[model samples]
Structures are given as structure tokens and as C-alpha cells.
Target: MRSQENGPIKIDGIDKMILNAFMENANIPVSQLAKDLGISNTAVHQRIKKLETSGVIDSTKVIVNPTVLGYSTMSFVGVFMNKPSSYKLVLNSLEEIPEVIEAHFTTGNYGIFLKILCRDNLHLMNVLNQKIQQIEGVTRTETIISLEQPIVRQIKL
Candidate 1:
């Protein structure tokens, strides 16, 4: 994808088609995608290369099911900081905790918001009290347990 005047990256219909196909199945063979798109394998390969080089396509990842691994609890925690300057330190410390799957420096009532996965409520409690709360810059936390994730998707191209 290339942009005009360094504006938003522009993608043609073909690029959108390729991206949509990959979004459905990342492991789709280039030849199959080429056949579906009515393009040569070389063209498909070149387009994918261009997309990757332009940073339009990030890395392909294997989606892991946390429940299968005994991680049944998913919680969102809003972390309150003792001071604004302590953010980096708190963030660095949070990175050490494996249960913290995602963290965001956000606006509003929280300094940092985190997505945590654990085996159960007790495991979550342990993480919150013994791990997150123990961090020097961390003052308090508010957690919301996710009972079900009804919708999870990427933005439509």
C-alpha cells in the first residue's frame, strides 16, 4: 500500500481482496489465493510482499485458547498509579507477569488498563494482591471479569 502526500495508506480492490482472504485463513496457500483472485501466483506473492513491507500486514499469529490451557478466567483491570511518573516502572513490572496478556495506557479514571487471564477467581486474586498490588507505583486496581466474549473480530477492510 502506498499513500498520496503521506496521507492514509491507499489499498486497491485487489489488496482488499487479498487481505480479506488472509483474514479468513492466514495459512491459505498463495496458489489457492491466486486462483480465487484470478491472479498469477507471482503477482499474489509480490502483492503480499509489498503489503508486508509497507507494514499493512503484521505478523501471522497462532490463536491460543486459554481455556484449553486451564486459564478459564479473563479479567480487565484498571490500575491506579501512585504517581504519573511511575507509569514506566509499573508497566515494566506488569510485563513480568505472564497472566497480563494485554496492557494499554489509557485516558479516564485509570492510568493503565490490563487484560489478565488466570485459572480461577482465586488465581486472579493472587495475581491482583500478590503481584499487581505489590508493585511500588501501583496504588489500587478495579477488575471486571468477562463472563463471555460474544464478539471478537478485526476491522473490516
Candidate 2:
């Protein structure tokens, strides 16, 4: 149940209800959840603690909107590394760049896939040329700019 890679945790009906409520609004007060579930506030608090200790719930974070920050460009870049051994080095370099929001090692033609956010196309180009492409082991990259994102959601519980 505690293994993250083994899929969902082993949880009871009450845990499921608490999780669903948390997933909808991470900041929801435990007292509110307790009242809604017809349970004591202490019970709700203990359930939350258990969920965290058991790894069912990770850290709660505020989700920020890129558009509001004037970062209008979102690009997916497939990076081709010079060698497989260079992955660690490239990843370290990518992590240093503020524009590279997310990176995933994959089993496809490319070595790594990157999600980058920028102020505009020009900013993206600057980041690609001055930062990403300048890495020692980066051979090439193919980037696709997202025109629109219609669907974005967390996994269904």
C-alpha cells in the first residue's frame, strides 16, 4: 500500500471519502470534512495524518497559472542526447534553467521530453539557443508549442 509505483494504496471507505474531498480542495478544513462526513474533527485529522504517513497523499502545493504571470508560451521539447551516459549531466543542467518546468526520461526516440514555459516565442527561442542547446551533451531538440490546452486534470480517484 505504501509503494508509490505499485499503483493506488490500500485504503478503506472513509479514507477514500477523505481523499476525494482533499483532492477536490487541498485547503479544505478538516472540521468541514468531518462535519460533511458525520465524523469527529479529531478522526478527520488522524485520517489525514495516516494518509500522509502512508504516502497516499504527497505534499500539498498551490497551483499557479502561467498565463497570469505573463508566461504565455508552453512548449514540449524532445531532446536528443549525444550519449545515454549524458542523461544525468543534461538533467542537472536542465534543472538549473528556470524555463524548463518539467522533464521526463522516456523510452522513445528521444532521450528526454521537456515541458518549457516562456514569456513568448522569442523568449522560448532564447532559452532553447542560450540555455538548453548550449548544454554539452545535447545533440538536438524538436519543440512543439501548445496553441491551447483544453483538458488538464489530476488522475481520478
Candidate 3:
């Protein structure tokens, strides 16, 4: 099952061209897509459908401006668990916290990595003290707040 998704994606020349076009403009019109790919509109539509079904393409969405919405800080928290069996409970608890934008289980000094976003230092402190640190298995947390976000990419294609 893993190999099926990992294996070569069956893309023809037209599909690659279509993906290139979509990379530039996700909301491109079907007629324009066909024109850009030099294929029939129906072919472009079918290829897009295939890409979506194969998970080569995900849904298009508007990028939210974090500064506009008052989310000024982005922080990474490295959480260390007290015990070996604590990982599951810690992960479940982390999943319930909305501020945890991204989390990953790692094989290193830290058991979990959490990407957190908040409006200010006060908000982050509260979240760490009142929410994250209170989780059952959490022993220690190390936080690094972002000074600047130089590059952010959704994906090229």
C-alpha cells in the first residue's frame, strides 16, 4: 500500500504541462489550461481529474496573512517526554491543542516537535503554562520563537 503512493506517478507529457500551468495558476480556467497545454479542453479536464484522484494535486486555497490576523509569532517547541510509553498520550494531547499547527514525532533528544503560532509572547507563555506543559506525559519543553520568516512555500506543483 505504501509503495503504491511512492511508486512512479503515471504522468504523460500533457499531464506535466498541465501541472506546470497549475503550478503557476491553480484557479486557471479549463479553456486556458487547454490553450496553455496545447491540448483539448476535455483532455485537460480529464488529466486534472486523474491528478486529483491520484493525490498528485490537492485543493487550491487562498493563503492567509498571519500578520493581518494578529498572529505575529511563530514558535517551535521541542517537548521531552518523561517515559517511553508517554509518547502516545503526549501526541493525543497535542492533537487537541489548536495552536499546535504542526507536530512530528522525532528520534532525537526531543520526543516531539511542535510548531506553534500566537499573537505575542504573553499568549505563547500562557499556552505553554496552561495547556502544553499540563499534558500528562510532557516533562520539559524548549521553545525557539521565529525572528523572521524568510521563505515560505506551499509547493511548486
Query: Could you give candidate 1's per-residue lDDT for residues 1-157 as a string of tens digits?
Result: 5743587778899999999989989999999999999999999999999888787888889999989989999999999998999999999999999999999999999999999999999999999999999999999999999999999888879
Name the weakest run of 10 consecutive residues (lDDT summed) in model 3.
1-10
Candidate 2 lDDT over 1-157, as tens digits, reads: 4555777678888898888887889989888999999999999988889889878788899999989999999999999999999999999999999999999999988999999999999999999999999999999999999999998877666
Decreasing TM-score order of the candidates: 1, 2, 3
Report the number of the highest-TM-score candidate: 1
lDDT of each: 0.95, 0.92, 0.86
Local error of candidate 3 at 136, Å? Answer: 0.5
List where candidate 3 sits over 4 angstroms from the true fold: 1-6, 154-157
- Write one digit per residue (lDDT tens) for candidate 3, span 1-157: 1224589677767777788777777788999888866779888788888888888777877878888999998999999999979999999999898889999889888999999999999999998999999999898899999999998655543
Question: Global CA lDDT of candidate 2, please?
Answer: 0.92
Query: Model 2: clashing residue pairs?
Result: none
Q: How large is the C-alpha RMSD of every model relative to the true structure?
A: 1.5, 1.8, 2.5
Model 3 local distance difference test score: 0.86
Please give the lDDT score for candidate 1.
0.95
